[model samples]
Target: MSINARLFYVYRIVSRMYFHLSVLFVYFFTLDLPVWKIELLLGVYAIVLLLTSKLNAAMLTRMPHKQVIALGELIKAGGLAALIANEHLGILLVGQILSGLGYSLAQGTDSSLLRTIMPDMQAYKKAESGSSSYTFASFLLSGIIGSIIFNYSHEYAFWCSIGANAIAITAVLLIREPAHTNTQQEARGAKPTETSAQKFWKLYYSITRAFAMATFVGFLPYYFFTQTQVSLNIFGLILSLFTLLGFISARFIVRAGNVYGFAKIAATSALLCTASMALLGSSSYLPFGIVALAVLGLASGGVRPLTLSNLNMGEWTPTQRTALLSSMEQSFGLWNAILLIAGGFAIDSIGFQWLMLILAVVYVVLMTVGYWLYHIHTAQPTAAAEQIQ
Candidate 1:
């Protein structure tokens, strides 16, 4: 691995550690607050994230990527500081807003920077997968460590998160942007045959895949505990297993995309996710549910790297790539906010099983239609060019 790739992996590890350190403490810290207030905090955070994504997209043309990443990390550390104080609901809301801004600013740029620095697309894909695996590993380790720390003091956990963020910021600062990046980007400009419609579909697929995974992550535990009657201890073990499988899949399965093609791998992943979700909804058997969860985990982990590989295949300019990726992040935040509001109402109205089944069918229809549209749009241009020739 190159120095940049190593530094990137280090950044991923510590940044993810920062993220997951307080994951289990969100509800715990807000226990005294009303449910409505907690929801308000989440709403504030999501809105801030969406708005900041737009801002980040606009700023990409003017700011250096490393500077943006470092500034975002600094801001995140400040946000963690506020949470560490934890005096009032108002303070917590401020913390969430700061964290959201920081997260949105930094989220898409790191991958963009990695792509810019690496001349070889294959190396970039490998590094991307490796970084993702590191992230998942960090998630597992940080969760365990955070839980242990939280058992003693919440403040200590938040402080440790800030320390991790600081380390990530340092890593970002150490990364040297290649001087030939722009030349390489220009040399590999989008193919003449590519169209805006094709680009849109590629991005759309990624956004949809991310939204589906987010929904599952948000709701699966509830469905398992309430509907399937899984005990807490067993559920925790299952979740750990899921995370482990995700790490392994990200590390190894993504390489298969090079052999079988990313599009095929992505489609297969989507199908697997749909099947797993449907199976979970249709069955009450504990073993079946566990198997479904495991499949979902593997699919979810590999799908992200595949989608990212697809998105970058166009060889867009750094600015264009960053803007599009930021837009995707914005879409994710919007969809997630919508899911948080609607998914609860859906479960209340129709129950978790029905909701899952409906979502499965809906996703299938969407994917089919998206593929058809992509085919029509791409085929028309090729046919026109051929006739002109």
Candidate 2:
């Protein structure tokens, strides 16, 4: 792999540092806003992330990738500093909105750039394994480090995230574009490839479907808030534990996908989700609640990467696909804002367990949607092949 490609891998390692820094964001996130208000902000923030994903995709296809990403990073850094000073709910919301752009740029372009460095599809997959695993491990490590930082000093913990992001920004700037990019561009017209427009729609479908899957996955927070009703400290610990477990479980999920293929793995995951939801709906005992929620963690961890990693399967370069994923993530924030608040309200108005019943039904419906879309996606190819015959 080229130096730039190595940087892409190394950048993943450095991202652990960014996670460490985010430990303190919860402080600023809730500073002036009520918990309900905070949830609302998060909802809006998610929508912006989706929009950012769209813009980043456009820029990558139409402009210089490196420069565009750098500009977004610069804006992010500035936005963070502004939040530190402004600290108003409105100001904080704006900062988060712009930060979505930063996320989109980094995710989309980084993977795309690495593809340029490693053009052979098989070779690229093999190479991605190392970075992907390290990044996964880093999540647990960051949570540990974040906990330690929070225990000692919340302010310092947040600063750690800032420093890590700063390093990421610098590292991104140093990466040199691959020589292959120009060669590929010159050879582009040799045979017409898929148009960017078709690629974009494919990207949209893959991501939105993934996002739909996530609607069920995000039950962690609701479960914590409603079922346990623990203090923020305990809530954080549980959430971290969930992520840590999810991180550990993700490796096995990857293998399962490789062995059985992503479609089957996804189907199996949906099955787990349906079962878990049913358990949550009917189980009155706290232990049953815990078990049901853990099942959710297992299902979510297993499926998230399966869907996210392969999202580019349609035709876009890794970068464009990643950007599409980022857009999907942004949509996630939006969906979260609406769904979470609704869940909270429903909990207050109706019984908490009843809300689970509704979500359970939603889960089953989403799985059906997943199955339908998979067939739809597969049918197109099969139909095309039949026509070719």
Candidate 3:
């Protein structure tokens, strides 16, 4: 990894640590508030995040990407500081809005900056292929440390978050924009914009894939114990294996991307993801279930890097690219919200087997439709030109 990429990896680890506690802090700190009020604040937070993702896109277009990164981190820090100062519901709501906006901006800008610094496909892949591993590590570390700290005092969690963000902000300042970024911008001239059809399909793919992935993660443990009657010890082992498999799969993404290309890899992973879900749903044997979960983990990890690399392969300007990525992230946010509500109903009313089966079918349909559109657009030269035009 290049210097910038290494710095970015560090930034992600720290940033994830801080964010992992954000919602927990709110819940514990606002324990005296009515449940409905707390829910409303969270709802507002969702809306703000979705809206600000789009706004962040515009900001990226007009301002320096590095400046946007700094601004975003500062906003997030300000939000954490708000909670420390006051525990009022209204204050928390405002803080959530700032936090959401900051995250949207920081995330998109960070990706854009990485692309700017490491423009080569192989270089980018090398830099980012271990992202899932980093996330898993940060998640584990933060979960342990944050829990212990929160147990002592809820305010301590908030303070730690604020400190983490401060460190993240300093890291952001160290990221220097590559000189080639300006050259590329000048060469491309005006930014090429995405057609509505292109945007719609990208968002559709993100939403459906995210929903399926979330369902798999959320339901797997419950299904395993309830249906398979697996021991908790074995279940924990399976989960750990899943994480390890995911990390191992991530290590191979760049090589896989080089051989098959991003779109093809995405299409293949989506198919395998469908099969894995189906297998998990249908298999009654414990060994089969274990293999299926491992396949799910592998496919999930591969799909993320491949899809992101594919998305970043386009010729759009940096701002446009980051904006679209932000939009895709928002699509995920929307899907998660929908799934949280719908998933509960599906699980309670239909049962886990039926729910997985339903999701498997959903994945099949989504992958079919997505790849169909993908082929239709790319298969003909004229169709491709019309899309760009």
Which residue ranges in model 2 land beyond 4 Å of their true spot?
Answer: 16-32, 61-63, 179-234, 275-294, 302-305, 308-334, 373-389
Worst 10 residues of 1 by lDDT: 20-29
lDDT of 1 by residue, 1-389 (tens): 78877888888788878433324324432356533354455556666767777666456656677878888888888887886576687888788889888988888888888898886888888788878887878876765566456556667667788889999999988988765234444434553444544354354545455445544545565566456766544555565555677788788766786677555666677788788779877976778877877877777776556556656444576666777777777766775666545565566577767777877787677677866666566657565323212
- By lDDT rank, best first, the candidates go 1, 3, 2
RMSD to the true structure for each prediction, in A, is: 4.8, 5.2, 5.9
Cα lDDT of model 2 by residue, 143-185, tens digit: 5566566656555555665666677667766777643243335
Which candidate model has the greater lDDT, 1 or 2?
1
TM-score of 1: 0.81
Model 1: runs farther than 4 Å from truth?
Answer: 18-44, 87-90, 179-205, 224-236, 283-289, 312-315, 379-389
For each candidate in the order shown, give its overall lDDT on alpha carbons. 0.67, 0.55, 0.62
Question: Residue 265 lDDT in model 2?
Answer: 62
Provide backbone clash counts, one per model.
0, 7, 0
What TM-score do all the candidates reach, one by one? 0.81, 0.75, 0.70
In the range 1-389, model 3's lDDT, one tens digit per residue, is: 56777778877667766533423523432467543344344445555656677766676545667778778888888877776667777787788788777887787677777777777866666666676457555644554465456546767767777777877777767877754234434534565655534543474447545754464445664566456766543544565455556566666865776786554555566666777778767866778778877777677655455455545444666767776777776776665545544665566567766767777787677657764576566546465434322
